[model samples]
Target: MDGLNRLPGFEILPPEAPMPMPAQDLSAAPRQVRRGTSSPPLMWLRRLLVIGGALLLTGVATAEMSLVLGLSRWSATGVVLTAIFALLSIWIALAFTSAVAGLPGLLRRSDPLRLGEQSPLPQTRTALLMPVYNEDVGQWSARLSAIRASLRAAGVVDGVDIFVLSDSTDAACRQMESDAVLALRARDGARVFYRHRSRNTGRKAGNIEEWVRRFGGSYAQFLILDADSLMEGRTILALIGGMERHADVGLIQTLPLLQGGRTLLARMQQFAGQVYGPLIAQGLAWWSGAEGNYWGHNAMIRTRAFAEAAGLPRLPGRKPFGGEILSHDFVEAALMRRAGWAIHMAPLLPGSYEQGPPSLPDLAVRDRRWCQGNLQHSAVIGAAGLHPMSRLHMLVGIAAYLSAPLWLGFLVLGLAVSFQAHFLRPEYFPATHALFPTWPIVDSERAIWVFGGTFLVLLAPKILALVAVALSTRRAFGGRMRLMVSGLVEILLSSLLSPVTMLTQARQCVDVLLGRDGGWTAQRREGEEIRLRDAFRIARGHLFLGLALTALAVAINPLLAAWMAPVLVGLVAAPWLIAWTASEEAGDRFRRWGLFLVPTEEAPSGVLLTSDTPGAGDDRAALVAAAMAG
Candidate 1:
């Protein structure tokens, strides 16, 4: 295709067009000579201390369990169970410790750098770039108009430009996008522009690189956003101001809150993010003062620094594990840091927002792609010259997916041990010639203590988040009773969904390991009713597993059945739970009851205006209608 045909919505300009040139000398770019006060050694020390402490506690618990098992008769199955239990214990403990560390930060609410009331208007030009792939063009135009209006209101429009770069493959979607772009241009003029690529080579990262090569020199910084992302002008100004003040800072990421949820699952996700996300993000920012990781969107990057250092090289080999890196944000951050530029996170910065998947199936689809991307990091983790912290970040990403399978294995092993204890004959006489008859024994009391401890660790973070909110922002989320009740509901629902998520992730991991590639696909953001038949088809494996376990537990012992009830219940009811939570009525009912309510949902910010709202620009409904008809 010709250049004009390749990019449907924009004209192919001559060489004389005001496009920026690439840097002639990369060494002239600002580079940090020394690490920030939160030095690598100190950061590692803190992380190791927390991890080491958790491991020590896990060791003690495992040793006590071993002794209890030894009281009756030591068995191989018991040893395996103890090991898995210890591993799981350490995982929970690490999270609990992070939350404990973050509680003070969240309660204090005094990150002056992030919460500064005033910042000088940025002098540098910044491009607000949004990459879309086969998305709803009408909705995209609405969101873009809202953001443009927000910037104009803040008087920051002079220094900002908005671009909608499309990698849409569907011809109808591309044509709709072209019509929407024309409408947006007619309303907003030169400040808004759009370009559609016929062949979206290398996906989003490539789309960004093409922009950088063509127009990167004209802008000092670029704010990358996803299709569902929304940001207030003030927050954008704050991010750019931070970059301007710190010459060596290459990127600054903000914590985005989930909003615009209309399904039960989405609302629950919004609530969890609002309540629990801060503590976790605060903890991360505490340790990763400068070497923070990027989350691909709602982030600003120095144009020159990114251009010089973050040109991603394709990995060797084929699909699934190699070729193009799907998760490029993390790698880019690491590369920028390695080239002596700092990456930071401003968790306290408000106004960054994004939408969540509407239901379990939608989330699972997105998660499958993420799972493959993260697993591919195993190859990148050992790349030469990467900072130790960067390696840790990659490892954590890998572990996040791997833990699902580990948990599943742990549960399966526990079931196996139970079966052996019930059905297999015990060897009373030792092969080494012991005279005394050995009895297989377990200390029920110690086992109870271990279980209680694990449960406490698992729930402590949520409790801490509740306490933090109550102490700091109680009025924002209604009264204490409402908050507590909502939390309880969230916990109950999460417990029900945890097994389903576990099975989904475990299956995805297994599929990736078996050489299956999760192709990049656009996520469905709008809520829709899920039929029972579809739900059952999606959750068939979970049902089969749950049924088999239930039968085995019944045959073994009623106590075993009781012990496995939570997992079994979730697996068996996965289909119903998915269908029910996906319904709009279910979500509306919860909202009416003030369950899982968020402050944003209660009162939306001014930046969230719809296209129909006055001052947001001309309506694009007719444009969308015309394009759809065509």
Candidate 2:
């Protein structure tokens, strides 16, 4: 018996046990040098073109509004509001234009190069690494078994190794994990291995780094998987092949689609990902080229490259914004890229799957952690030798969280300006030595046009995604009518949820700014019903904010109230909306009506089927079942 066998949950094979030989060294493997198509200047040119166009549109709109306000007086508040609007406009325009750029790629017959097939069965070993903390042992066992079965089916089981690197501290969970590993070994034999760490020093990144330092030398490549992640065997093989082919490519990230959703919130997110995720990903891939980002999991990395370049440096600051980078994936990608290794996004790749957070609360919790991590990137954005695109990725990530506060500020300023216009009297030609009295007037018609134009730009990506789906074979989402109806439902739900999310994100940003750390917490995977009282308690602030805003708007003017209606409505309905969306019953009911139906849900893939069914006569099934019972 080995030291590992002495652990409460561990079972190790005998020292004399025969194992499959590792793959040959590919360090001197001959490969053609392939440079990225989009150079930094060209990529920047494309970015600037879209941003400039947005600025032009915003400038025109702002000019029109200024003229309206200038008719009465040029208020400082007007200028400030225009600046905020410009920032928001530019942010959304970038997304809309990216979708526009991506539409053609999505419609193209051939997939992106990153997603394309490469040489089959490379003579190099790859490790499928799953880093888990306190997670459901049964689910983990089922997923691991399915992945092994998948590889076996693809005849690539011999080319890969599976590792469950546990950072779990709970004794019972560790024991359950150990038992599951033992059963899996009994059933599947030596290809799978398990190790539990007593101290999770650096958390997930630390867990992986420890593995790399210990066994990374044995593998040429490693595939990182989240606890909820699932990849088809063929997909894994393709990634390995790609790495073997592109020696300079350090990391390749696949767009993981959401599956196995059981709540209205989850289903809605699934539908969005299935329909809209591709467009956004396509656009990002198009622009990102070789400077793409890693999404933590459903990604492959060159073992040597990662080990050499991605040794994360501790930041020179206190908690929250500093210390070990919370969002390690992005920083790792940037570091790898900084070392001259290309990183790419494979959006067109299939068989990559990840489950969404089951409910609104679950999603918020995850977002909070991400918010902290992304904000931490602000410190790294200025690091030396980083590719400009890499910095942009970091900046964009930071902005994704920071935009919430900017939006809140914009709304508050707009309301303040509206109140000032309605309540305060205008000065007539006293301040300036002008003959004509400066009367403050708003060009209502022009303002309407500007508002409509902004809305159109904001909504264009969704419309484009819908059109792309419509143009394709409609069978996937149950034909054109259902697809269209589903799109509308998604839009409605997203719109209702936007205000609530905005406030939630705003709160998170404030918390981070206040030096509060979003400690690493395992996300809730399974859906649970939320009581009305619980929902109310969680969303009480939103309700109060809504009521207060509506009251103030009404007191200011009916027009103001009407303009603020959407925000007020969403905030006011937050409790019921959260409760309803969090309910699995509501999701199932909607599923019966064919609402929020995705193709994967309609016809699950073999990999998904295997993962979903853990008790199918395999020897490990009993172990998994017992673990679940425990």
Candidate 3:
């Protein structure tokens, strides 16, 4: 039972030592964490006083300006719109902040994640769902192989049912599914199975429904997995244990660290998520508690609860607002919560991991489908029977896609305001106010606040995430040096790719609104890159927006033009960023900067390798062999 016990659905690996790390000095792994006492009551009191005072001053000043400037006539409308904006902003801030704050609590409560634990799953059985469409079989197999090996090492490899739910309309993918299932087997009669439906009807949700309808009776719980995800067996066990401990919970979702991404863009995303994701996730989990929703993957759900709560509802018609819910996860989560079942997210499930999209275009293609789904959910927000938080989720889902249009509106409004102030001014010009008055940019002097606030919103999360990673894990991922260089590179790449990405996302939002689709596409393999030509073609999405911004900046001031150059250059070179981002060669070259997930052989000096389990470090060797043989 200690060394190699069976876990449901996982094949066993023979005992062999873990792969050895190159011998090197290892003094830096953090042995202690700073669990400082909560802020002094007086300190909090002072902060509250300062914050409240500022709010009071802001409200009074706004009133004074409106009254003296005779702008009070617009106050009623402004107040309503301002309240909406404030509420939306607060929701976002809470979702992210709560996710971050829950970490210390998580760190305090759970055992440090390690390898090799027996599942002791009791009598409960679990179904492992790997929902696949046109995804790369090799990539999916590799992740599952690692997960299975981890489970095998922990002992409890026999209590799980693994289903490869193929929604492949393509004949080749169907064959690929058959081949993959056949290749992954134990002496047990095909513990791994594949089923494809002729109707690939409602996309992912429909795919899941088919499984539930046919196989729901077999397992008490099911863990849904994205094709490109991996979870440590220990994490899986912890989730099952957590679920068993909490009877009213319908689902528990884990945020996986992004893995196997080769592009600079992908690494940045992965690093950002790893560094700050926990805090944001923790913050969300703390506030959300039992209202968290399923993300459709890397999550476990109670079968009966889901069946009762999340039956796919038909939309009124076809196209953007109809048929199946593209974003079924949030809606499903809301449904579970509305049904009075707790929907939770495990903020400390470290073994869980996923892959990031390698190229901008690829990500845009995926998001287009998501946009349609979310927009559709916008309507579901009004369903009278839904829980408040569930309705909030649908609202947020709609807002996320709509942000592009909002940003675009801000740009247009800024331009109109500028022209009015410069060419058609009619009073109202001390050239300074904290908030804009819908008039044209008064002398263009308020640029700093606008630029500064925008900058903070975009970059503060990265900084916060970085701080969280350093505070919590410190030397866990080797040393400060190993983590530092990796973080820096991730940030730089992310800044460069973001503008281009936003443009692509903007197009996707537009496309979804227009009722057109990019169609169902397959995910790429672990290391594949978009061709340079494709990258360039894709860059065209942002070029116009970028060039227009540049022209506007120049028209305003040469200084402004200079400041905005990166955005323009980025748009013009969108294809280059996409190509470089999607390229493994580029990723490998950057990895030398001590900035990312180095290939296994080229890991930097002084990296500390730990035994996954308490008893031994042998399972990794077995894992390598089994993975290769397959």
Candidate 4:
């Protein structure tokens, strides 16, 4: 009874292997170190192409918008609207161009490092570090067991060990977690270890650093896994093999597919990720090359490199903008790159999987937390010695959240412009000797062209992703017709949900600006049903905003109202939409009709099959009884 509420017979943790992880100084000069993998000329060219293309697209779109708004007689409101539109347009343009650039890689399914089944496993010891925080014990245990089984089957389990790092504070939950691990250890012995920290301290990053300081010396590399992460053993071996083969490489990230989606929202995410994720990831990999980013989980990291280079320092100040870094992965990658260690992405790697948020509300919670983390990156973007690409990575992360507010401002300004058009009388013959009156006119025809073009750009990535799938793996998604239908469903749902998401993220940005902390909260993985009251509670703001927009649009003009119908409808129907999508029944109904059919669901791997079964690893009742008996 070590005061941790540790279950009897599972009181001891594995012996510690001390390793130093010192805090990094942002102002320190760059380290002069050994030569690492150099970024190819083509990588630089790819970056130039994507960046230049986005800028060109944004410039052209902004010029068109300016013309539509009567550029020569541009009002203050018109200028502001144009600025916001330009800001918003760049992100979408970048995405469109990036997808286009990545299409070839996606089509070819390129494996740049030549990693395959023939790759040899490393002899060095590795650890699988799964950090849990008030998560479902049974589910995670089962997943870990399946992973263990997977590794054993691959003949690499002998060199790797599994560590269940618990930040769970609940005594009962800790007991259950301990009980589950006890059962696992009973079967597997010292290969499995469970350690609990009384204080969460710096949250997940801290939990990991603590582990590094305590036990990192025992392992040459460690793979980070989210509570929901599940990897096939071969994928794990391949990542290790990559690290071993490329000694200069510090980290390697995999594009984990969203699997086990049982809610409508989750299914949509899965479908979209399966269809669209490849192009985006490939594009990233193509441009990023050796200077790639880490996505926190389903990734492998060189233990020494991380310990030596990725030590994070707390920023000066309080709450949201300062203190502990929230988005640690990006900063870690940047630091490692600064230390001249190559970071790479293996987008073509398969068998890396993760779960998605079960509902929109759940997504909002996660996004809010991430919003704070990304916004905090503003302080670190200017840190000395960071690679140019690393700086761009942080900047893009901040821009991702900022784009929501920019969109809101754009919409609001457009509404104001419309109101001005309907209410204010145009100055006819303002100049005493004017040849013709400037009618405060908006070029409706030109505006249509601009709108259509913007819409097309926004839709380009999805279309490209669909085309890539159709060309390569149509049968994987229930054939071409079903895939198309699923794509349509995903697009429609995403469009309908966009406005709500925008408002939510806009509010999150505002909250962060107001110095509110999102704090560490447990994510709801299981797709629990959303009741009407809860749905209404969650969506009241959206509902109110929707109604306000609808009224304002109608008052301004019938055409304006028609133009805003989709946004207004989504806003007004937020409650029903959230509830309906969160329903397991709705998800099942979609499944029955072959909608949102991802390959993982159609054809599960052996590990997934094992996870679905009631094994001793996660048989909670049996574990509980066994622990009590012990």
Candidate 5:
């Protein structure tokens, strides 16, 4: 189809070059990924340290908890609660140790690929595949234009093919996309193609696979991007160079930082990602080494390797956990590893970017789909010939969602035991006619200590992130004072949001388990002002929950209520918090005060800045109307 074909029936895709993608079997063994002899010992040591530290921490916490509850007088309920605490503590301990393990790498600023400022252009041809659904065409097209401009500036535009692979079902959206593509081609005078599928089978995974089948043979590597993703020209080159240098590597995933946040929640997310994201990613990369998992976007992959190893088979069964894999990235990495291909993460590489959900309600909407996808990993975790690390990756993905409900259970069970202790008659008189009936009580001081320690365990990583930033990257975050203030604001906001997120995720888990499918829904990238009625409607359940917990705790004892204040407050203020944080004005107010300041906000990249800037002869009203129509 030509660029002038503005009709709804036409598409602008390239010529076909079919590549076979055979379905992989989960039960059978495939060739294992071969690595250098030096890697195993280091990999084993890192794994051992993380695993061993978690075990050690859990064991010590269990003993302390046991002591606090008085093991000699332990009720069945107390024992069960203690076991649950131990399970919860393991996740915390693992994170804490991983942060510690990764701190050195961040401080040193290690670059594994050695992609310096004057890096030479990559020799291999690459395809930049952006698969869109019902997205705002104006914003999407602008970002694409910015990317093409950045690439052209870097003198690598000749080696790259930009393809807009659309699964957009809306006719208006399709027409707008076609028009936008034509505009981009006319304006940039660059090679850009567009393809639209009438049937979005398998959703995004299917969109990509269709591209691979039709046009995969022409490109040596393909960089997969989401609708919201943008990368600097240099970062794109660095990724291509990294792939070229490592022939055995199947994929190299960049650390895509959050950008373009305008709401309070979005800025908070931006801050957390800016401050804490690197430490977490560094730790993951250190241990994961060549076995890193894909996040599905902003990552480049070898066309042949992906075609040979990452083709997905529909999980046999019904919905939710069955049929098409909702989270295809992790499974694809596993399948690639099973076929002897390495997957690596370049955590230190910068300039890769994406947008975050602008409100808590929007986040919940997005997370429901993720929760379903991660839960589906339970079926793929046992697949044969997968690397142990790959399996661990899937297990971690499953636990990430499951942990929320587990935490809720812990809270409820603890509350239940508290109720039983306060309401039930003491059984101390049965043993002997004691002068004073033994009270059903724990060591209050020890219990306080245990609680304090658990809180510290939960908060330490954030504190460590602050310390790391202060010592190294403070200037990037608008100097030390700004960084510290931003860190504090982030911690405060995150604490308030945690209970609400926990409850939301717990509900999502229940929905997924109960055979509810979180069908593929388009993400709302640019947020609107959240109305009070809308916020309250979404958060009424959380509000009711908060009130219920508050009354129950107060009835038990004021100190118990005080102990649960943070969580109770979060629940009670859910609606107001949602509405307030969804305000762009509130986010702007914080930005003025230099609170929640991220590097991207202080000094934006050229491509990112260009995305927001209007081009010459542009019709602003028309673009806004088109975007609103989507």
Candidate 6:
């Protein structure tokens, strides 16, 4: 059998109309082509009025609902708020626990660079493997070339080999990939390489195995990057150094701080990530130490160790939910740890980057796969006999995925309590009932269970990340108002958006269990226009549920119902909300409204940190020169 057919968990893509793959000369894929000019202001204003109006309406509801809880001493009000509070508290505890423990441990990493270290360990050759099924190869190479430049800059060019392992059967992508490799070769030559299998077997994991089985013996270390992934040259060197420093270490994963995402949702996400990523990272590092989780990107591993632990068992079930592990990185980490090797995470080093989905629907589609992947692990954790840290990672993954469902149910239960206390259970209503109703969403009993719990665990980590970044780089972010406002807006939008995401994922899990299949699609770049239909589809269900809940909530107070109406309304219009969030026009509006922005050259160094300065020629030219001339 061809290598591709041998892998158990794979989906065959449909054939495209015949066209010659881009020739090798076409390899230098357009790294960044300016698509089209900005949408006109009149057009922009039209779109913003819609989403902004929706958000403002929702915000009013949220405020009223929260305010109601503060005034009334109704017995049931206390009960609902208290429940929400309790849930929030637990979330807080988990967040604080993780941040305090996890973040530091990641940064204080002490893995010594073996090459530069002791005598017993000889200089080991390493291969950096980037496996692409169907993606922009030139775009992919441009990123890797940056890393190669970084490695060369560190003067360790000879020690590292990069292979672009492609499973793209399409003639176009194949040629595009070939062209990129040639372009890279023109710059970096043999040190940077490319390969493609006639057929792909078991998705991503299977692709890696194909290489490991063949050239596994040649390299002492191997690194993995997602097609869209990148890391600062410094981060790569630091990772190698850390691995060498710690003899027992097998892998070091850098948290991928995503970039280049447009659309309202994407911008909101980017803002949240930039603001809150650090604290959570710090917390995770402090707790996990050498036993951190692997997120499948910007990570390094011992080639020998991975090969020894190689054979991943095909899952027991059929189709989507079962077969190969969708979330293979975690299991890989677990296997490494199980094999007596330390698996770890490094902080957001400069140039470590990933792309966010262009639109909301696209992101949901992606999450569907992730939800299934994480859910499948439910059976793997205990059965595989993983280490304690690995199990925690698995459980947390499950919890984070499942939190939406739990919160949804919790919200329903809370509103039910509000209805019961304010309208139905007159006995529990205080004398003030004649003068003032329990306001809205003021169910103390359920509020704690819902909002409180979420804030503690889910939201707290982001806050922590934000605080750390702000404290360290106060001047860059301006005063606290911007940060605080940015955080609040991000949190509010995310909360509204998440219900839609959870529902999508939940359905995906169900689909997998039912034996339907899904495939990996290339992530749409930022600034892509989102379709109205796609947006509406994603948000429709959430809006319906949100409205229902809000209406029921209003049984106690019309003002509360009126207040929450926008958020509930957004839920029902989830698909549209998602689409709009992904819209470039929406993204521009967010920017105009002072929503968010990322550095063009966010990398610490010139290339990764900032794209070529206005007049400077592309750095890739230098790499091309080095590869061809050398």
TM-score of each: 0.89, 0.90, 0.77, 0.94, 0.93, 0.76
Indicate the residue-level lDDT of 615 in model 1.
25
lDDT of each: 0.77, 0.79, 0.60, 0.85, 0.84, 0.61
Which parts of model 4 have CA positions greater than 4 angstroms off? 1-12, 38-41, 71-73, 425-439, 614-630
Overall local distance difference test of candidate 2: 0.79
Winner by TM-score: 4
Error of 6 at 542 (Å): 2.7
RMSD of each: 5.7, 6.3, 11.5, 4.3, 4.6, 13.6
List model 6 lDDT by residue over 40-152, tens digit each.
12533432443344344344434434554665534664546545544434444555555654444334442323222322222666778888877765567667777777766
Number of backbone-clashing residue pairs for each candidate, in the order shown: 2, 3, 28, 0, 0, 81
Q: Which stretches of model 3 miss by more than 4 angstroms?
A: 1-100, 103-119, 186-190, 424-454, 476-478, 481-489, 525-527, 530-533, 597-630
lDDT of 4 at 93: 94
Error of 2 at 192 (Å): 1.1
lDDT per residue, candidate 4, 156-224, as tens digits?
748888888889988878877777776765555437778888888889999999999999999999999
Lowest-scoring 10 consecutive residues by lDDT in candidate 5?
1-10
- lDDT string for model 1 (200-234, tens) is 77789888888887778788899998988989888
lDDT of 3 by residue, 1-630 (tens): 223322222222223222211211112111222222211225344334433443544454334333432332255534443343343344344433444455565555432221123446546878788888777666676556556666666675688767787777677666655555545553223256667666787688877776776677667788998887677777778778766766776788887777556666676666667666766676555545555666778888888777766776766677667766678888777766666677777766657777777766667766877788888886567654566656766776777777666555544444444444555544333344323333332223333443454355455556666665666655554456777667776766666676776666677788877887556677653546778777656666576667777777566544545655666677777777778777777776766665664322233111111111111122434533442354
Question: Whose lDDT is higher: candidate 1's or candidate 4's?
Answer: 4
Can you write out model 2's per-residue Cα lDDT over 1-630, one digit (the tens) per residue?
222343445533222222222221212222223444322347667666655666676677667656656544355776776777767776787788788888888898335454465547759988889988999878877888888888877778586878888988788777777777766665655466788887887789888887887778788999999989999888998888788777787888999999999999999999999999999998887778788999999999998878867877677789897777789999888877877788889888888999999888999999999999999998888877777888989988998898888888887776666666655754423444443223346655566667778788888999999899999876878778888898999988888899999999999999999999988898889999999999999999999988988887776655557666778899999999999999999999988888888988798888889899753234445765553343
Worst 10 residues of 4 by lDDT: 1-10
In model 2, where is the ten-residue run with the lowest total lDDT? 21-30
